[model samples]
Target: MRSNRDRAILALAVSTAARASELLGLRGADLDWGDQLAQVRRKGSGAQQWLPASAESFVWLRLYLEDLGPLGPDAPVWWTLRRRERSGDVLERRPLTYDALRAVLRRANTALGTNWTMHDLRHTSALRMVRSQRLSLRDVQVVLGHAHLTTTQIYLVEDDQEILRRVHQYLADQAEPSQEAVASESTVGYDSNDLAVLLGGVPR
Candidate 1:
């Protein structure tokens, strides 16, 4: 909602599904304004790939950048809102360090009453893409910058809650009166003996 630099960074993280380290390394020249693509350097292989970011992400990015003037090619895309006096006496617009990002998330967790990690943000991105059914798994792997397809396949695992929901629905269907029950008027219904095992019931 807010267009602060932190929100811009989060928007890019969720939309692009880039790793926190990869995003932290973003420079002014890395973003393609016309295409809404961000060039990220992979952590393991050091391969450079362009990730498609959402239009809304770029809008927040632009608004965040408006606070700071134009940046040179090598200037970091993300910057700290306030300079820490503990760091040094001289004032400077420092790049958003990994520690600072963690601190931001810590504050967010406090307010949300939930613990969330950067990896969870990536998981959310992957799930959103998979459920949308617009993009293929391979497409997601490319954006996520995963070296192995197997690593990308982790997102395909079914959620436990979904599994439990289906199980409950199946039990409910079985418990309901079936078409056969209506036709025969439960003529084949089990007696108290079967009910004893199932429902612990017996007629006097």
Candidate 2:
């Protein structure tokens, strides 16, 4: 079973495409339940931007918040769970650090047998929005808060296999009309040599 923290990490990464530091910096006040938006601090500009939270992300976040119990607005959204030594098995809550987040991701990667960094999840989200969801590049740029369209273009690269499939489809479409024409003409007493000439070939 996945922990609340783990679920929140994955959901926010894929849904919001927020950087690790930005995500770690999130407080309870940043999430607006009614608006379905999370206010994140942009990296370079340090400007605050609002990102839409997906329904799936909202569900997971709500479950996590319930487990987290009531907290003040200034309290961190993601808290580090620490075991208490004095108390007979009580978990203490503290602000989750970047290092702690990395450790959590590392453990998750080991369990899943895949090497995925936080940024990888961001890229995956970008590609999914562009390719699978068929969203515009400008839309993705807004979601990712990219300053330039060129940066968003990097994420729009099509897969080689998909490109090849399209090429094959085009070639098949071009050949079909010519093949049908040749078949129809051949039924009118045209020999192989005449058919070859009709198809732009010199008779042998």
Q: Which has the greatest TM-score?
A: 2
Model 2 per-residue lDDT at 130: 80
Error of 1 at 81 (Å): 4.7
Please state the error at residue 155 of candidate 1 in Å. 0.8
Tens-place lDDT digits, model 1, residues 96-192: 8889898888888888898988878888999888666688988888778777889988888787997799899999988997887787986667777
Q: Model 1 off-target regions past 4 Å?
A: 1-3, 81-90, 160-204
Q: What is the C-alpha lDDT of each candidate?
A: 0.85, 0.85
User: Which 10 consecutive positions of candidate 2 have the poorest summed lDDT?
Assistant: 1-10
What would the TM-scores of all predictions be?
Answer: 0.74, 0.75
